[model samples]
Target: MSNIVIYHNPKCGTSRNTLALIRHAGLEPTVVEYLKTPLGKEELRALVAATGEPVRALLRAKESQATELGLNDPTVSDEALLDAMAAHPILMNRPVVVTPLGTALCRPSERVLELLPVGPLPPFTKEDGEVVNDSGARRA
Candidate 1:
């Protein structure tokens, strides 16, 4: 197993960009195509714990099924969200990066930097044209 791993969704632009950033950082990560390799409840819980984020935070609220299943309701419990995410992989957010430093949801993609060691990060421009400098700070 590589030192780093990414629960990735190739179809998601943020996920794709995060993966590319990991590669550009000179680390070959173990990519888990989560939709195909759907995570179990235990795995999902562990991932959420690793990121120090609540299960609800890891959920993709915008996922169509989230609304249909009433997962968008604030009253939904963590267990409920975790169960839904386990049943519908798409309910889980994309590009959760895990490294020795830590794990992150990588929503903006740049959040992956926090999981990398202190070193030069890959300079990349996001789809929005925001450039991530070598220091991992975004530049116009």
Candidate 2:
């Protein structure tokens, strides 16, 4: 089994880029297509906890469902947030990576590097033409 796990959304460019970065590091992570295989409440809770961020932070506010379901409201309880995420997988953000190092929501995609094994990360260019160098910094 792979030591790394990436909650992926194939339609998302950031998620695809994060997976590429992991491959660039030469590690095959277990990819979880969360949309297709929705996570349960308990699993969602664990994943949220692993990111070291408040439950609301992981919410995908861009999704219309967030507002329609009232998940975007600040007053929403963490339990309610978790329930919504379980019911609508898209409510959670994309590319949440879990590794031996830690878990993180890889919004910029390169954030996955932090959860990867400590070493030199090869230079990679995102689909948007943004280049990330070995040291995980942008290359102009």
Candidate 3:
């Protein structure tokens, strides 16, 4: 099994579903409630690098602080955004799952499956004899 860590926000449905999927897949991941125990600046930067996404993409744009801080404006610098996220973890995005090999942003929740260790998940049929769809709901 892959060594996994999940930065989770319990209040978010996406985060809850991601945890459920991980458990259903038979992989136990270390859960980090990021809102309660936030990531440091260095860790946040590293996660951005690991995911190969821009700093803004990692932020929770819907957060009121983002608007209050004028983070939605294109003029906002990466440093400024990072500082905001560090200061207000509520502005950080939902579950960010990391594996021994790589990390993924579990946005829709299903994305975490890509970080799973190679091999099919254990088989379990639904009541209708169809495989369970662990893939999460699509976001707008």
TM-score of each: 0.91, 0.93, 0.83
Number of colliding residue pairs in model 3: 0
Please say which candidate is ahead in lDDT: 1 or 3.
1
**Candidate 1 C-alpha lDDT tens digits along 39-104:** 999999999999888888899999999999999999999999999999999999988998888888
Model 1 deviation from native, Cα RMSD in Å: 3.4
Candidate 2 vs candidate 3: the TM-score winner is 2
Count of clashing residue pairs in every prediction:
0, 0, 0
Which whole-number lDDT from 0 to 100 does residue 106 have in model 2? 93
**Candidate 2 RMSD to the real structure:** 3.5
Runs in model 1 with CA error above 4 Å? 136-140
**Arrange candidates by lDDT, highest first: which order?**
2, 1, 3
Lowest-scoring 10 consecutive residues by lDDT in candidate 2? 131-140
lDDT of 3: 0.79
lDDT per model, in order?
0.87, 0.87, 0.79
Q: Candidates 2 and 3: which is better by lDDT?
A: 2
